[model samples]
Target: MNVLSVALSVLETALVFVVMVSVLVAAHEYGHYIFARLFGMGAEEFCIGVGVRPLLTWGRRRYRLALSESERAALPMAEGALDAGEPPRELNEETRFTVRAWPIGGFVRIKGMVPQEDGSEVRVPGGFYSKAPWKRLVVLFGGPLFSVLAGVLILFFLYWAVGATRPAGTSIEGIVRGGPAQAAGLLPGDRLTAIDGQPVLEFYDVVSRVRDQAGRDLQVRYVRQGVERETRLQPKLAELPDAVMGSDHLPTGEMRRQAKIGAAFGLVHVALGPVGALAEAVSRPQQAVVGMIAIFERKVKVEDSVGGPIALATMTDAAVRQGILTLIEWAGILSISVGIFNLLPVLGVLDGGQMVTALIEMLRGGRRLSYKVQNAMAAVGFSMIVLIVIGVFFVDIKRLVMPSRPMPEFVPIEAPKR
Candidate 1:
C-alpha cells in the first residue's frame, strides 16, 4: 500500500480504537455513577476523558430560580426575558457532566470517596466515605461489574446475529504452498474424511492426526468436488518464532519446533438460540478471567500475552478487515479484559485497591486512614501504574516498528512431465 493509504488505515484504526475505548470507559464509569446515586452518594462530576479542562459541559442549571426583582435586575436579561409577574424558571440541581479534550479514559468523581490533600473530612450528607463499608464496597465494585456486563451483552448480540464459529467437520479452508498438505494435493474446500484409516470427525482431529504422525507418511483421504481422493505425505517440523509461539519466557532468538501440515482453516458458523447465545456470552467473561489468571501465574508469557493500547489498535484493525462480526467479537473480548484488569487488587487508584482500603477500614471499626497517608499510598500506586503503562507502550512500539520474521513460504511441488 502507498503511504497515504497506510496513513489513512492507521487513522481509521485509531479512530475506531478511541471510540471503542471511550464507550467502554463511559459504561464503566456510568456503573459507578449509577450505584453511587442509588446509595445517595453525591457525585460531583461524571465525565468522559481526563484532562484539566473540559471542552463541553452539560447538566448545569440553565436559569436561576426564585430570584428577587432587585437580584433579577442586576442579572443580564436574555432576548426573551421573563414577562412581568412571571415566576423564575425552576431547574434541577446541577451535576457537572463534561467531555474533556483527552480521550484516553474517563471517571465519575464521587464526593468523599477519597481524601483530598487539604485533609478536610467531607462531613456533608451523602458523602461516599460516610457510607457503610459494604455500600462503599458495592460502589467500588460497580465499575468493573458494568464493564463485564456490557461485554456479555455484546457477545450475546453477536452470537445471536452472526452465529458462533465452531468446528462442524473436517474441511480445509486454505493450504500453504509447498506445505505437506499442498504437496499431497489437498485443496481449499476439500473435506478430510479420514487419516491412516481413522475417520476424521472435526478439523481438530485432522490437526491432531497430522501432528501425531509428523515425519511419518500418512494416508490421507479427502473428498473434493464429490470425488474421493487419497494422498500420502509426511508432516514437517516447522520452527516457530516467539511471535508465533506466543510465549514471553522464550528468548528473543529462540524458536520452537512444531509439527505442521501448512494449512489454514476455520470452523463453520452455527447459529445460536437465545439460551445458547446467553450461555456463550456468560462463558466469554469466565474464559477471559481464566486466561488472565493463567497469564499472572506465568503459564503465559507477559510479553506474548499482555497488550497495550497500540496492540489493541493493531488487533482492531485486523479484526475490522476480517468482518463486522469479528470486530464486534473482538470488542467484547476487549471489554472483558478491561473489566478484569480493573479488578486486580494491586493498584490503589483502581477499583480493587479502593475495595482493599475499604475492607481495612471496616476491620478497623470505622476508623479511616489519615488523608496524608491515603494520598501518599495513592500516589505510589498511581506511579506504579504509570510506569507499567509506559513499559507496555514501549513494548507495543517496538513490536510495531520491528516486524517479526514472516513464516517460511511453502514451495509447491513441481508436476511430473507427461
Candidate 2:
C-alpha cells in the first residue's frame, strides 16, 4: 500500500476503535453513575473520552450549565473560566462531568469505591460501601444491565432500519439428496403455500401432512417469483426414532416407519412491528451469549472465530468502505459481547465477580468478606484478565505474521490494475 493509504487506514481503524470503545464504556459506566446518583451515593468524578494532558490545563476545564440568566450570573468566578471558545463540561457540586478532546471512551470515580490507607472501606453517608448490600448489588449490576440494554436498542434500530429475518410462508432451505422434494422440482426460495389445496401457513402444517402421506401422491402448490405453480410428489418411507412418530422420549433402538419428504426450511426478511423488533433485538444478545458459552461444548475454537484488535481493525476498515450502518451493527454486537464478558465472574477484574460478592453479602445478612480474602480474589482475577489479554494478543500476532493462507499485498492507488 502507498504510505498515505496505509496511514489513512491506520487512522481510520484507530478512530473507529476509540469511538466504539468510548460509546460502550459510556453505556456501561453511565449505568453505574445514574444508579449511584439515584441511591444518593455520590460520584466524585465522571470523565468521557481522552485528551492531551496539556489541553486539560487550558482555559476552563471545569464548568456548570448556563441554565438561566440568573444561574449564569451566579456562576463561580474561577480564574480564566470560560475564556476559550468552548468549555467542554457541565458541572455539579457532588459530581463533575468533563469531556476530553477526543470525545470517546469514559472513566468514572465514585465515592468509597476504594478503601482508605487504613484498609477500611469509607462508610460515609454517600460512600459506596456504606450502602446496604442489596443497593450495592444494584449499583454493580447496573453497568452490565445497561450495556445489554444499549445493545438491544442498537439492534432494534438496525432491525427497524433493515427488516428482520423471519419465516415468510414456507420455503426450502435444503432438499435431501434424491428425495421426493428434489424429484418434484422443489427448490430453495420457492415458497410452498399448500398441500392438496389445504392452506399451508405454519411449519407444522407441512410436516404433519407430509408425514401421514407415505406412498401417497400429493399436490403441492408453491409461489416462485410471484408465480404460483404445482408439483406432485409421493412421500418416501423413512426410518426415524420411535420418539417423534410416537410419544416416547427415548429411542429404545427401535426404528419407526415415518412418511417423509425431506427438506429443510428457510427464512426470509420480514418487516417487524415495534414490539416484534424489540423481541427480535432482545433475542440477538441472548443468542450471542449462548453462542459464546457454546465454545466449551460445541462452538468453534477461539482462534478460529474470535476477533482481537487486529481483526476488529480489519472489519472496521471494511465496514468504513460499506457505510455507517455496518459500523453501527458491528458496534451493537461488540457492546453485547463486552457486556457478557464482564458478567463472567472474575472477582476484582469484572463487575460480575464483584456482584457475586455483593450477593454473598446480601445472602449472609450483610456480612462482608475480610480484607485478606478480598485481596486474594482480586489478585487472582487480575491475573486471569492479564492472561486472557495476552492470549488474544498472541493469536492476533500469529495471524499477522504467519497467516495460513497468503494474503494479497495491499496495493496503492498508483498501482497498476490487474
Compare the candidates by lDDT and give the number of the best one.
Answer: 1
Error of 2 at 120 (Å): 3.4
Considering summed lDDT, which 10 consecutive residues are worst modelled in model 2? 241-250
Summarize candidate 2's per-residue lDDT along 273-367 as a digit string, tens digits: 78767776776576666556655444345675566777777777787778887888778887888778778898876889989888988898987
lDDT of each: 0.74, 0.70
* Candidate 1 TM-score over all chains jointly: 0.74
| lDDT per residue as tens, model 1, 101-132 | 88888998876666766544434345677677
Model 1 scores worst on lDDT over the 10 consecutive residues at: 242-251
In model 1, which runs have C-alpha deviations exceeding 4 angstroms? 1-11, 60-93, 116-122, 175-191, 194-198, 204-262, 405-418
lDDT assessment of candidate 1: 0.74
Best by the TM-score measure = 1
